[model samples]
Target chain A: MLSVLLASGVANGLLYGLVALGVVVLAKAANAFNFSQGDVMALGGFVSYAVIVTMGYGSVAALPIVVIVALFVGVLSYLLLRPLMDAQHAVALLTATIGLSFLVKGTIRLIWGRQGDYFAVPPLVSGPPIILFDGAVIIPLQHLVMSGGAVLMLALFALFFRFTRLGLFMRSVADNPRAARIVGIPTELVLCSAMVLSLVVSAVAGFLLAPATLIFPDMGFSLFLKGFAAAIIGGMMSLPGAVIGGVLLGVTEVLVSGYISSTAQELSAFVLIFVALIFFPRGLFGGRSSRSV
Target chain B: MKLFSQIVGVMLMTTALAVPAFAQDVQGVSDTSIKIGTFGPITGANYAFGRLTMNGLETLFADVNAAGGVNGRTLELVRVDDQCDPAGAIAAVRKLIFDDQVFAIIGGSCSNGVMAAKEDIEQSGIPFVNFAAASNNISAPEIENIFTSMLTSNLESALQAQYLSDLGVKRVAVVAQHDAWGSDRHKTLLPALAEKGIEVAVDEELSMEANDATAQVLRVQGSGAEAVVLLSYPKPASIFLRDAARLGFTSSFIGTSVIPDPVAFDEQVAVPGATDNFVTISPSRYALDSAEAAEWLEKLTTKFPDDEPHTYNLYGITAGQLTVAALEQAGADLTQASFIAALEATSGLETTFAPGPLNCETHQCLQAAAWIKRTPEGKTEVVGLSTLD
Candidate 1:
C-alpha cells in the first residue's frame, strides 16, 4: 500500500508540478501572477480532445495542433494584458486574468457543453499495467509516461534557461524588469515570449494529464486552485520550488488518503500550503534575492 | 341622498358576485394553450441531467402539440436555468410562480436544488411533476401537489442492496459522493444494506470533480469485498472503474438511476471490458437505441439536432407524459386545484419508457427499476427488473 500510494502520489504530483511550473514562470518573468493558467491548460486538453476524438486523429497529430493553439492563445493573452503590463499594476493584472479565466471557462463550456460530463482521452501509450513485485504492486503505463513527460519537460526548460539567449533575457527580466529594459531588452516582447513559453508548458502538461484527469470544462478551476496552492507552497516566484511543492503536495495527498481517509486527501493540499506559508515564507528553495532561479 | 345610497349599495353587490368567478381562473391556463414551467441546470457540471431532460420535455410537448394538441390546448413550455444550485432553484421556481405565472411545473433535475425549493413549491400551491430529481424527500412525504415520476433514492438504494444480497455478497464496498445527491442515497443506503444482511466492508467518499481513485481502489481491493456500490454520478464512477481495472481490483459494480445508459457509461470508462461486471438500475425499461424507443428517439433527434438520444431526455418525456395526462384529466375548465386533484387520482398510469406503472400512493410514483448491462459489442441489454415491495 505504501509503495502504491507513493508511486501514485509522485505521478500525480509531477503533473501538478508541470502546472505550477507554468504559473511560476509567468510570475517570475512577467512580474505577473496569472490566475488563468489552469484554464489555459484545460483549453489545451479540450483542443487536443477535438483533434484526437472529434477529428479522429491520433495523439501525435494533437501535439502540433495544441502547440499552435497555445501560441495563438498566449499571444492574445499578452495583447490583452499589454496595457496593464505597461502600467505595472499587480492587482489590475491579477483581476484581468481572473476575468480571462472566466471567459476561457465559459468558452470551453459553450463549445463542449452538450458533449458529455467528461470526455476520455486515450493514454498516449496503450498497454497494460506495469507489474512489479510479481503483480503485488502495479503501476499504470500512463502514469509512467506522465511522470517521464513531466521530468523531460522540466529538463528541457532547465536547458533552455541555462543555454538559450531567450532564456537569458527572461532571467534578466525576472531579476529586474526595469534593469532589463534599460539594457535594451524589448520588455514587451520578452514578456510576450514568457507568456507564450508558460502557456506551451501548461498546454503540454494538459495533454499529458488529460488521460488521467479526463477532459471536462469544470476541471479547470479545481486544477487551477491545486496549481496555485503548489506555486505558493514552492514560493510563487521560484520555478524549482513550484515543482518541488507540487510533488510534495501530490505525495502528501496520496499518503493521507491511503493512511488517513479520502476526505483528508482533498484538504491535504490546502493544509500543506497553509503550513508552508506560516513556516517557510520564502519556501524551501526560495532565495533572498527577488530573481527566480 | 336616498337615490345615491341605493346606487352605491347595488354597485357593491355586483362587485362581490363577480370576484369569486374571476378568482377561479388559473394563472397560466387559457382557452387555446396551457403554459407549464420547467427548471433545471441548463449550465454547469450537471447540465447533462438538466439540459437533456429539458430538451426531452420540449420534444414531448412538440409531439403532443403535433398530435392535435392536449384537449384543444397546445402545451407551452417555459424553461428557466437553475444553475443546478439551491438558490438558483428557488429563484427559478419563484420566477415561474410570480413572474411567468405558469399554471403547472413539469421539471426538476438537480436533487438538492429541487429539494431546496420544495417548501416554496408546496406553499405556492402549484402542481409540480418532478422529472429527474430523485432525492427521496422531494416527494416521499407526500406533498399534495408534488408528484415524482423518477424512482426515489430510497427505492434505488433498497433495490441496490437487495441486488447485492441476492448475489450472496456478504461483504460489500461503497463509494459515494458526500454532496446532497449522494448524501440523500448514502444516508438511506447504510441502513438498507444492513437490513439485507450485507456487511459494508469499506465506505469511501468521492467528489464530483475527482479525477483519480487509486487510493480508494486500493482500499476497496484490500477490503476483500464481493461487490462495490457506487453512489455517484457517471464521472467519479467512471474514474473509479478505470482505476479499479488498472489496479486489477475486480468486483461486481452496482449503480443507480443516475447512470441510465450502460452503453454510454462503458464508453465513458474508456477501458476495454472494465464495465463487464457492471450493472445499473435505470427507471427506463427501454434502452436509448432499442426498437421500442426508436420512434421517440427519432422525435428527440428531430427536435434537438446536435444532441444524441439520452436517458435523461426519456426522463423528461416521462414527466411531460405525466403532466399531460393530469392536464387531460383536469378537464377544460382547468385550475391549480383541479390539476392537483387529477394528479392525486392518477394511479397505475403507464407511460413511454417507464419501468413500471406510475402509481402515486405517497407522491413517489415509480418504485421499480430495470437492471442494465452493456455487452462487449456495445449493446445495452436489460437483464432484469426489481421493484420495492
Candidate 2:
C-alpha cells in the first residue's frame, strides 16, 4: 500500500510540476503570471481530443497538432497583451490574462460543450500493471509513461535553458528586461518564445494527464489552483524549485489522505503552501533573489 | 353621411362576431402555438444536464408537432440559461414567467437551483414540470402547479437503503461527495438507514472532481464494510471503483440515479471487471444506447446534431410527453389552472423510458426506481423495480 501510494503520488506530482513549469516560464518571460495557463492546458487537451478522436488521427499524430495549436495560442495571447505589457502595468497585464482565461473557457464551451463532461482520452500506451513488492504495489503502464514523459521533458527543458543561446537570453531578460533590451537581447522575442515554451509544456502536461482523468472546460480551474500552489511553494520563479515543490505537495496530499482523512486532500495543498511560505519563504532550493518586484 | 356611418357600424359588428373567446386567459397560449419555457445551466459545468434535457424536450416537441401537435397547437420552447445557481434560477424563472410569458415550464436541472426557485414557480401559478432536479425539497411541500418527473433524493436514498437491507448486507459504508447534490442524498440516507436499524460502518466524503480514491477505498475496507453506497457523479465514482479494483478490494458498490448509465460508467473505469460488483438505481429503465431508446436516440441525434441522448434527455422527453398529455387532456381550453389540474390527475401514464407507471397524485410524479446492474459481459440489466413511499 505504501509503495502504491508513493508511486501514484510521484506520478501525479510530475504532472503538477509540469503545470508549475508553465507558470514559472510565463512569469519569467513576461514579468507577469499568466492566469490562463490552466485554460491553455485544457485547450490543448480539447485540441488533442478533436485531432485524435474527431479528426481520426492516431494519438502520436496528435502531438504535432497540439504543438502547433499551443504555439498559435501562445503567440496570439502575446499579441493580444502586447500593449498591456508595453504599458508596464503588471496588475492590468495579469487581469488581462484572466480575461483571456474566460475567453478560452467560453470558446471551449461553445465549440465542445455538447460533448458533455469527462471526455476520456485513451492513454498513449497501455499494458498490464507492473506489480512489485510481492503484489503490494501495483503501477499501471500509463502511470510509468506519464511520469517518464514528464521527466524527459523536464530534462530537455533543463538542457535547453543551460546550453542554448535563446535560453540564456530568456534568463537575462528574466533577470532584467530593460538591461537585456539595452544589451541587444531582443527582449520581446525572448518573451514571446518563453510564452510559446510555457504553453507547449502545459499542453504536453494536459495530454499526459487527460488520458488518466477526464477532460472538461471546468477541469482547468482546479488544476490551475493546484499548480499555482505548487509554484508558490517553489518560490514561483525557480524551475527546479517548482518540480521539487510539486512532488512534495503531491506526496504530502497522498499521505495526508492515506493516513489522515480523505476530506483533507483538497485542503492539503493550501496547507502546504501556508507552511512553505512561513518556514521557507525562498522555497527549499529557490535562490534568495528569486522573489521579483 | 348617414350611409357611411351605417357601413362603419356594420363592419365593426361583423369584426366583433368574427372574434373567438377563450375559456380562460392563458398567458402564453395563442390559436396557433403554446410556448413552454425551460431553465437550466446551459453554458456551465452542469450543461450536461441542462442542454441535454432541453434537447430531449425539443426533440419530443418536434415529434409532437410533426404528429399534429397537442390540440392542433405547436409547442414552442423558450429556453433560459440559469447556470445552475439558486439566484440565477430564480431570476431565470422570473424572466421565463414574465418576459417570455411561457404557458408552462419544463426544466429545473439543479436541485438547489430548483428548490430556490420553487417559491417563484408556486407563486406564479404556472404549470411547472421538473425533469432533472432531484432534491426532495423541490416537490416535498407539495406546491400546487409544480411537479417533478425525476426521482426525488429522499426516495432514492430510502429505496437504496431498503434494497441493501433486503440483500441482508449488514455492514454498509458510504462514500459520497460533499457538494450540494451528494450532501442532500447523504443527509436523507442516514435517516433511512436508521429506519432499517442499520448503522453505517463508515461515512467518507470525496470531492466532485477527485481523480484518485485509494485512501477512501482503504478506509472503507478497513471499516470491514461489505457494501458501499456511492453518492457521487460518474467521474469520482469511476475513480473509486477503479482504485478499489486495483487494491483488490471487492465490495458491493451501490449507486443512485446519478450514475444512470452503467455502460458509460464501466467504460470510464477502464479496468477489466471493475464494475462487475456494481449496481445502481436509475429513474429510467433503458440506457442511452439501449434498443428500447433507439427511436429517441435517433430523433435526438438527428434533430440536434451535436447532442447525444442520455438519461437526462430521457427525463426531458418524459417531461415533454407528460406536459403534452396534460395539454391534450385540458381540451383546447388550456388555462394554467386547467393544466395544473390535468397534471395532478395524471396517473399510470406510460412513456418510453419510465420504469413503472408515471404517477402525479402528489407533486412527486416519478416514484418508481429501477435497479440496474452491469453484467460481466459489459451489458446492463435491470434487476428489479421498486416503488418508494
lDDT string, candidate 1, A200-238, tens digits: 888888888887756788677788778778888888888
lDDT of 2 at B74: 94
Stretches of candidate 1 off by over 4 Å are A86-88, A133-137, A288-293, B1-24, B42-47, B58-74, B83-88, B331-333
Docking class of 2: acceptable
Strongest candidate by DockQ: 1
Q: How displaced is residue A62 in candidate 1, in Å?
A: 1.6
Docking class of 1: medium
DockQ for every prediction shown? 0.51, 0.35
Local accuracy of candidate 2 as per-residue lDDT tens digits, A13-46: 8888998988888887776778788888888888
Best by TM-score: 1
Interface RMSD, candidates in the order listed: 1.8, 2.4
Q: Which residue pairs in model 1 clash with each other?
A: none
Clashing pairs in 2: none
User: Residue A248, candidate 1: how far off, in angstroms?
Assistant: 1.2
Expressed as tens digits, the lDDT of each residue in B235-290 for candidate 1 is 89998998888777788999878888889888888887789999999998988888
